[model samples]
Target: MIPGVSINEILTLTSILFFIGVYGFITRKNLISILISVELILNTSVINFVVINKYLYPELLQGMLYSIFIIAVAAAETALAVAIIINIYRRTGSVAVRETETMKH
Candidate 1:
């Protein structure tokens, strides 16, 4: 439709990626893997914004700006999450989600 690429194809890929991220988040028990899954989900949103903006409003930079903001937030989130995970691991000697079930020692 648009030269060589179609919006549907982009949406389809984004949907697949989103589901994969969801599956990873639901099935993974490890902290790092879950973090990666969250990143994947965030990335899909970024892709959708970029693609829609590119096709619908090539003159505006709103989508690119939003994607940049999301990337910044994701970076900050990953840093904070990693720091918290490390702190928990140091105290509990494990990074598994099940180990954080109780705050009691």
Candidate 2:
């Protein structure tokens, strides 16, 4: 697909993206930044599914179905995370990662 691109190249790109997301998730202190990182991580899986299906299983729709499902779940997760982050900000005046621990009290 895409003229001459191979699955190995595509997978390599996804792996890089995934690791960047993981690094962001680990280093970010803001809740919104962490959410963005999580979204990025989820998107790599979606890309992998689509790429694999297009290159290896062109006869089946499983890849498309799985990608769609992942997108829907990611959307729902993003909405919920945003809502929770907003609530936390309203209560604590900060959306920092450490601030969330106060919610346990």
TM-scores for all candidates: the values are 0.90, 0.93
lDDT by residue (tens digit), candidate 2, 1-105:
687899999999999999999999999999999999999999999999999999999999899899999999999999998998889889989988887774564
Question: How many clashes in candidate 2?
Answer: 0
lDDT of 2 at 39: 98
Model 2: colliding residue pairs: none
lDDT of 1 by residue, 66-93 (tens): 9999999999999999999999899999
- Over 4 Å off, model 1: 1-3, 103-105
RMSD vs true structure, all candidates: 2.6, 1.8
Question: What lDDT is reached at residue 78 by model 1?
Answer: 99
Q: Specify the highest-TM-score model's number.
A: 2
